[model samples]
Target: MLDWDDLRIFLAVARAESLSRAGRALKLDAATVGRRIARLEEEMSAKLFVKSPQGYALSEAGDRLLPHAEAAEQAFAGAQEELSGAAGQLTGQLRIGAPDGCANYLLPQVCARISDANPGLEVQIVALPRVFNLSKREADMAITVSRPTAGRLTVQKLTDYHLHLAAHREYLANSAPLTCKADLRGHRMIGYIPDMIFDKELDYFAETEAQVVGLASNSASVQTRMVQSGAGVGIVHDFAIPFAPGVVRVLADEVSLKRAFWLIRHADDRRSERLTRFAEALGQGLRDEVTRLERLAADTTLAGL
Candidate 1:
């Protein structure tokens, strides 16, 4: 005899990791969310979450209940969409997890277009420095650089994009000559901290002998910015060049990297037609963006020549 409203609240709180955040999402006050959690725990006769300074962490019972709640939510959404007589009528929030680069440069435009078409849908982008955990329900869908090896998830290759060693024109003009890869050692370089790299696929410097980074950050966007500011040279995505106006590819003949993005979602949610369409839209958007990136890279290369 548990209330569906309570389960909805519980799911929101678990996802947001804070009562205040869940309340804002649900359009309820924080006090109301707290009262509902208290009621839910009383009805279930078990504590659901651990209240802490870092926000709410799900207890063992809450973790066990999460999948059931998500399943129920999906069922309700399917029924609602079917009853409305439009498979395109999606009315729930989809949280997408992705690396900082894609989250900042790609998904905002993509999600905006999707949300415009589906007026009832909300898209939340969770930009993380590391890989997203689909099994933990960290996101409804994720865009990953590396293909997951183990998980009950549906994954698709979105698109392949290129990265190149780049530096600001001003930096190149003002600093040492870089006629060869060996010259990289003498220049101030911006890159990710070696110890903080979360995935092997992101280890762009692995093969290089460069041992020093003048400035380090976990975010590709930040590194791009530093390079744009003429702080140092760094590797940047071809697509991201549009943002860094003065940044230009250097050592193009010697340094070109290719990487791909994979879209992933829970296996059980594959039957959700709305989710499927959204994922497809994401793939198409990325493909279009990759095409643009290729053209840009070609143009830049020609200009440099």
Candidate 2:
């Protein structure tokens, strides 16, 4: 019989792609992790991993075994949750991966509320500029700007948010008057580095003719900060505007863009009651927060008018 303990070690190694890293995560020495993997391979009678300078690469056998292992892991987790009487309250660690904009402006408050309600729950947010790999278990769940077309993943539309051309009041005061998109051509634009835009949804400037990006970063927060510093005009999220006091919408009627945030999870995770509850809470929290922030931005805009 395949040992459940060995399979757990196998999963750690597969995800970390290094014995030492996996060992650290499992709180065991490298030799113990290696022995566990070797034993598991012997029991299965197949080579699960191949060593390369880049680290452990899953062999065909390992690829074939991965889903089964994950399913088993899920089953065990569900059983543990049921036995531990945690069905009424969320506990343990939950990690979420998201683009830095949401991470910086949105999740902090939302997660704080959730954590406060569920005292035993621990939340970790992994903020990055690129897409997360759900299959590799990079996070328990993820928030994304665009729905992924391929993957064994389930996507839930959390909420729709808006963006518009914006600049610091001082920057607008110093620059030439803008009545239309044509005037944007003369202004220094702040935006994502062109080629580094990971998703088409993120190509906020593609729909407009303003081509030159004078200041750019792959991060949304950085782009917003540049605009706050009066560096240049850039497309800024409506929900994020309230956070930057001096940044105000520009050409609001003309250059508005709409986008949606999607919650992504492994399809198999749907069976976990803990995750399902958390997903519901997270979705509602995000919608509420977005609406609240956007309203604040609107009030700020009206006050400026």
Pick by lDDT: which candidate is best? Answer: 2
Model 2, span 1-305: residue lDDT tens:
98789889999899999999999989999999999899888989999999999999899999999988988988887677667765577788899999999999999999999999888789999999989988778899999999888988999999999888888988888887767888889889999998999988998887666969999999999999999999988999998999998998877777879999999999988887889899999999999999999888765442222
Best TM-score goes to which candidate? Answer: 2
Q: Measured by TM-score, how close is model 2 to the native structure?
A: 0.93
- Residue 280 error, candidate 1, Å: 1.0
Q: What TM-score, computed on C-alpha atoms, does each candidate reach? A: 0.84, 0.93
Q: Evaluate all candidate structures by whole-model CA lDDT and list the values in order.
A: 0.85, 0.89
The total number of steric clashes, by the backbone 3 Å criterion, in model 1 comes to: 0
Model 2, residue 14: distance off in Å is 1.2
lDDT of 1 by residue, 1-305 (tens): 87778999999899888999999989999999999999999999999999999999999999999888888888887777678754556667789999999998888888887788888788899999987776556888899999988878898999999888888888888887887777889888888988999878888975454668889999999999999999988888888887788888887778788999999899989887878988988899889977876677655541231
